[model samples]
Target: MGKRFENKVVVITGAGGVLCNAFAAAFAEEGAKVALLDINEEAVMQNARMLTEKGCTAKGYKADVLDQESLKQTRERVNADLGTCDILINGAGGNNKRATTDNEFHDFDLPEDTKTFFDLDKSGFEFVFNLNFLGTVIPTQVFAADMMGKKGANIINISSMNAFTPLTKIPAYSGAKAAVSNLTQWLAVYFSKTGIRCNAIAPGFLVSNQNRALLFDADGKPTARTEKILRNTPMGRFGEADELLGGLFFLADEQQSSFVNGVILPIDGGFSAYSGV
Candidate 1:
């Protein structure tokens, strides 16, 4: 592979999971010094070790995106180990089961066993909202400081298709991701003069541990929910984690996307565009 990011320092939050782990490897493969940040120390450390074994410049740091002080410590560690960051990927976010509805649609009259909109827990909703929204904001607040006034510095956010269209049963995630997309635009304008660009990637359904329960049956076959998703998606398949790498690498590359800003690039296999007509 070519050294597009030779000597460039990339920081990725939520690097413990499948998506961000792939991101860490991809950036490192392109000759960038990648710092993997995650609240899960064991997983992040394992990923960092794996990348190092592959001869990629990488290190893992424990960081909670929700805590500013924790991020400060992480920033210090990253700066010391990998130099000031050139790219920041805010990827730490997930849905809470407590915040998700049990059923896809609400009925006029519901049973107590069912988690309808009326019975949704306020604390659960708040946790989900804060995890996805504040998760991005806090990390940006801490990590973006390193890129201030630095030429070609960029920020890439992780949004979802649900941000554009509220999917059934995940109202909190949909709303929080929408906030991320909106904040991306606001920050782009706010930092226009700093030569720093901000953009987001709204990914389609990817088969990962997060949603595997809903998508796969006991025998490792596709569930009814998976069929529905594929039917709505024009491409008739789920995207792979590595599929997101190209869009991410393009947005990270200043030449390809220097003029691009505040755009929510969708890599959803046309799932966001299909009208279900």
Candidate 2:
């Protein structure tokens, strides 16, 4: 069978990170010219080098998702280097340790060092919120300009399981991702007339370097949080980052999902369905 994305230009933000880096590789293997954008210069450059060495047409660019000017400049470079983006993946988002509460529930006699809802840093909250919500907004504003009239142009935003129902101790992240999910629908309707489709993928508990400590102990035993997650997940396991590829590929390929728009497809192994009942 012919490659699905042959000759397409795919741009992914947060391409330096593990999940998005995997996405970059997948797109390249599908015959797309991939553009990896990340705030970390060294990380993105190294990833780009690896892809290029593998004979994939890929390049990395340094661009902060929150900075419009940085994104504009990166867009110019991407157009010159890879052509206007046909698929834009707004994957640059994350939570902050300071913004999260130490305990899921409030304790009147909590330790002084313990962070609570009241103890959450305002700056940290803003950083996390902006990184996820505004980060998605700004990148779409900059790159969607190029996709205005292009055939099969679309955007994929990253939402989280916290979006559907807020997770404990992560108010900022939950709120921010909820905004992302809402924005996905709004963008779809707004761009429906402009020929640019918008949708999102909400992933469940996937253990990565970012949350390894929270999920498992140094001795490789499951943490309390991990147990809770597994119990709630109908699949009784954490999802693999590679497992998200099927949903992504379905949404990005116009021939397959031309009629699918404004949907928040969850790749969470039934986490959203099981209500602990």
Candidate 3:
């Protein structure tokens, strides 16, 4: 409605998911031509169609963030469809159950079937790491080419609370997101002279479709982990997907965030501030 991004092309990875879909709609509402990139071809295309029905300039493409070649191809298609990307949001990443320990603590008497730290699979760690870290790196590599020297170019990476501190049960995701935060700072400095600003959003506990299983039990009651999370979070509630738009829009807008770079903004409702004391 503000038209802050009028005529600008915005690219969002994981565009089919709960959080990223909200991002896509928000950008489109702000008058940006949005390119929704996701590994789920059908879902992404469906989202694209819905946006089209709303008269928003939007399209969807199949992309695997870990696949550099696929990203390059996506860039080409997006350029041809919606023009060059001025804003890039790397939102494709998730924690796999395999990469998560079965229990939060170590005990010798734990069930043999439980996946403890010692029983963690290298492949699982590799999968989660590649999905979160390389996912952001490869897309930036492919798309940042168009952003160089371009006015109002901004790149926003998605980080998690685990990036600031290791979260229990998901070591691989924690490490990978930490890498993402580190890489975000590196890119901001590397592209400082190119007129491109890179930053990240480290979100706290939010109930998205991706992590719903872990947050809720089979009977739909909040799990013990969810209770712990809410107790630790000062806000005592999970963030809604739309709540991220303010920070995102601010960072993406040149007038608003021209001097803001290399910083990881936490929209966590003060979850990071709590010391559990």
Top candidate, metric lDDT? 2
Q: lDDT tens digits, residues 44-98, model 3?
A: 9999999999999999999999889888988999999889999999999998887
lDDT for 168 (candidate 1): 89
Return the lDDT, model 3, position 38: 98
Tell me the tens digit of each residue's lDDT in model 1 across 170-194. Answer: 8889999999999999989998888
TM-score, predicted candidate 3 vs. hidden true structure: 0.98
Ranking by lDDT: 2, 3, 1
Screening candidate 3 with a backbone cut-off below 3 angstroms (N, C-alpha, C), the clashing residue pairs are none
True-vs-predicted CA distance for residue 50, candidate 1, Å:
0.4
Which of 1 and 3 is the better model by TM-score?
3
Residue pairs of candidate 2 with colliding backbone atoms: none
For candidate 1, the 10 contiguous residues with the lowest summed lDDT are 103-112
Model 1 misplaced regions, further than 4 Å: 109-112
- Candidate 2 segments whose C-alpha is farther than 4 A from its true place: none
TM-score of each: 0.97, 0.98, 0.98
